[model samples]
Target: MSDADAAVGAEVDVDLDFGDDGLVPAVAQDAETGEVLMLAYATREALSRSLETGRAHYYSRSRDELWEKGATSGHTQELREVRVDCDGDALLYLVDQSGGACHTGYRSCFYRRADGSVVGDQVFDPDDVY
Candidate 1:
C-alpha cells in the first residue's frame, strides 16, 4: 500500500456505532462551500473503501450492493475528511464535488422544500446522462 493508503487505513480504524442493520447514515457535504450534497448509507467496508480510495462509496439499499459515487454519471466526489457525530451513529463526509450531486441533475439532494418549490439549479438533464 502507498503511504496515503496506510494513513487512510489507520484513520478508518476508529470504532463506529453501526445500527442493527450494520449500516450508518452518511451525509456528504461540499467541503469548500458547505452545501449539503447527498445522504446515503454506509457499511464498514464502504467506509473503509472511501478512506482507502479517497473517494465516496455508499451502500445502495435499493441495489443491495456497494457503489462508488459517480461511477456511471461521472459526478464523482473526492473525499476531504470524515467527521463522526457525537453518537458515533452517523458520519459527515466533507468532499470536493464535481458536477451535480443529485441523480436528478440538481446540485443537491435537498433541492426542494417541504412545499415542493423548484429552487436548486438543474445542472444537467437526467434523460441525457442516465
Candidate 2:
C-alpha cells in the first residue's frame, strides 16, 4: 500500500527491505507540522499493526517485542502516512501525535543539543508516569 493508502488504514503492498535482523528503521514525523518526532525499529508485524490500527507500532529491540507507541504513556502517534525510501530499507511514518513523544516528557526525542543544552521547554514531566 502507498502512504496515502496507509493513512487511510489500508493494507500496504509496497516492497520492503528488512535487515538481516528482520527489522527496519522507522522515522516518525508530525503529519501537519513537519517535525521529526522519533526514530524506532519496526518488524513486519509492527508495520502491519500500524496499518491495521491507524496507530504506530514498533519493535522494541530493548524489550524484544512489538509495542504500540502510546500503550503505556498515552502519547499515541496516530498514523497518517507511511513512506518507504527508494532503497526500501527505511520508512517514514507521518502521524498525528498526542502528548509528548519522549520518555523524558519532551515533544520529541531529540530535545537535547550536542552542546548539552536543551532545545526547548519540556512538554510534560516524566515523574508523573514511568
Candidate 3:
C-alpha cells in the first residue's frame, strides 16, 4: 500500500452511519476497470466482516443474514479498497471481481440505461453458474 493509502487505512475509526433500519448502502465497484458492479445493503456485522476478511460481504434483507459475494456462483469479489462517503452514510467497495457481478450474468448491475437502452455485454451465463 502507498503511504497515503496506509495512512488512510490506519484511520479506520469512523462511526458508520447506519439508517434507522440498521442498514447502509454499500456500492461495489471494479477496482481496475472502475465499473460499478452492484449496490447492496450492509449491517454493522456485514461491514465488519468485509473489512476484516478483505472480501465483499452484505446483509440480505430478504434472507435476513450476512452473505459473501459469489459464495454460491463462485464469482467472488476481493476487496481492493474501501471508502466511506463524506457524510459517512454510504460505503464504496473497490473490488477485484473474479467473474460477473450481476446475477443476470452482466459485468455490472447497471445493465440497463434509464432510457431503456440495454448496456454492457454479458460476461457469463447465469444458467451455467446459478
Candidate 4:
C-alpha cells in the first residue's frame, strides 16, 4: 500500500458509524465502467477487511458474518475506493468487477424490468449460481 493509503486506512474508525442494527449501507459502483452494480451492508469486520485486502466485503445480516461479495460464485468485486457519506451511515464502493456482479448472470444487480410498476425479470436461476 502507498504511504498515503496506509495512513488513511489506519485512521478509519469503522465502529463510529454502524447503525443500530450494526449495519452500514455499502453502494457498489464499477470503477472503470462507472456503473452502479449493487448495494449491500457491511459490519465492522467487513469494512476492515475491505480496507485491508482491497476487496469488497460485507455483513450478511441473515447469516450474521462477514462475507466477501461473490466469494462462492466466482464473481468478485475488487475495491478501488470506499467513501463514507457525511453521516458515516452509508458507504460508496468503487470497484473493478470480475464476471457478473449479479448471480443471475447480469453485469449488475440493478437489472430489472421497468414496467409501469418496476417488475423483475429473472435471467438466471438461483440454483445455477450457488
Candidate 5:
C-alpha cells in the first residue's frame, strides 16, 4: 500500500468504544472556520464510508438507517479529517461545509441559545428545500 494509504489504515484501525447500541457520537465542525456545524451519531460503517468517500455519512437514529449529509438538500459536507477523542468514544469530523449545516436552514445546529433566541442567520429556507 502507499504511505498515505497505510497512514489512513493505521488511523482507522484504532478501536473506537462504540456504546451498547454500536454507535458513537460524532461532532462535525467547519474545517476553515473551526465552527461546530452539527452533532450526529455514526456507526463503524458510516465512518468507513466517510473516509472512503471523503463525504460525511451518519447513522440516523430516527430513520434507523445510514444517510449522507445533504444528500437531498444539496448542502453536502466534504470530509477533511476525523479525530478520535481521548476516550475513543467520540469523534470530531473536520469538513468543508456547503450551504447550511442544520436542517432548520441555519448554518449550525447551535443557532439558538438557552433563552430560545436566535443568534445566527438562516442561510436557507427549509420550506424551499425540505
Candidate 6:
C-alpha cells in the first residue's frame, strides 16, 4: 500500500491535475439513498477540505469562491465517500444529506427533465432559500 493511498483511504489518486480554470467537476450523491443530488465544481482546496472534514464543499464558478454546502441554506451534505475519476478530472461525493439537497425543495438538483421540457410545478420555492 502506498502512503498517498493510505492517507486518502483509496486505491490511488488517478491524476491530481486540473484544467487552467482551476476547477474539477464534482458529483454529489445520496450516501444511503443512492440518488444523485447535484453536480458542482471543486478546487484543490475544496477537495482537501471535503476529505478532511467529511463535508461537501464546492467552488462556485459564478461566485469565484469556496462554497460550503448548507452553510446558509442549512442543507449540508455529510461526506461518506469521496472518489476521484480515473482521469482525475472529476470527483464523486457520496454523502448523508440534511434538509433538501435541491434549492427547489427536491432531494436533488437533478429534478428537471432532461428532455428540455418546461417545468411549471415546482416542488419547492427558491424564495425560501435565497
lDDT (Cα) of model 4: 0.77
Alpha-carbon TM-score of each model against the true structure: 0.91, 0.92, 0.89, 0.79, 0.91, 0.80
Candidate 6 lDDT over residue span 1-130, tens digit each: 3222332423334677779998999999887778888899999989888777667899999989999999988889887778888788998988888877877777777776889664433455668876
Q: What is the per-residue lDDT of model 2 for residues 1-130, given as tens digits with 9 covering 90 to 100?
A: 6443456666777789898999999999998888888999999999989988889999999999999998999999989889999988899999988998889999999888899898855888999867
lDDT of candidate 5 over 1-130, digit per residue (tens): 4322321332485779998998999999998889999999999989988888778899999999998999999999888788999998999988889999999999999999999999976999999998
What's the TM for model 5?
0.91
Better candidate by lDDT, 1 or 4? 1
Candidate 2 overall lDDT versus native:
0.89
lDDT of candidates 1 onward, in order: 0.87, 0.89, 0.85, 0.77, 0.88, 0.78
Best candidate, TM-score: 2
Q: Using TM-score as the measure, name the better of candidate 4 and candidate 5.
A: 5
Give the Cα error of residue 50 in candidate 4, in Å. Answer: 0.4
Candidate 4 segments whose C-alpha is farther than 4 A from its true place: 1-16, 113-128
lDDT, candidate 6, at 122: 41
lDDT of 3 by residue, 2-120 (tens): 32232222236787789799899999998888999999998888877777777789999999989999999999988877889999899898888888999999989999999989888
Residue 48 error, candidate 3, Å: 0.8
Q: Write the per-residue lDDT of candidate 4 for residues 1-130, one digit (tens) a residue.
A: 6422432353475535786788889999988778788888998788888888777899987888889987898678877778888888898888878877777777878877565443333445567888
lDDT of 4 at 25: 90
Q: Highest lDDT among the candidates is held by which one?
A: 2
Extract clashing residue pairs from model 6.
none
lDDT tens readout by residue for model 1, 26-122? 9999988899999999999899899888888999999999999999999998888888898889999888888999999999999999999977878
RMSD of each: 3.0, 2.9, 3.0, 4.1, 3.4, 5.2
Judged by lDDT against the true structure, how good is candidate 6? Answer: 0.78
Instruction: Work out how many backbone clashes candidate 1 has.
Output: 0
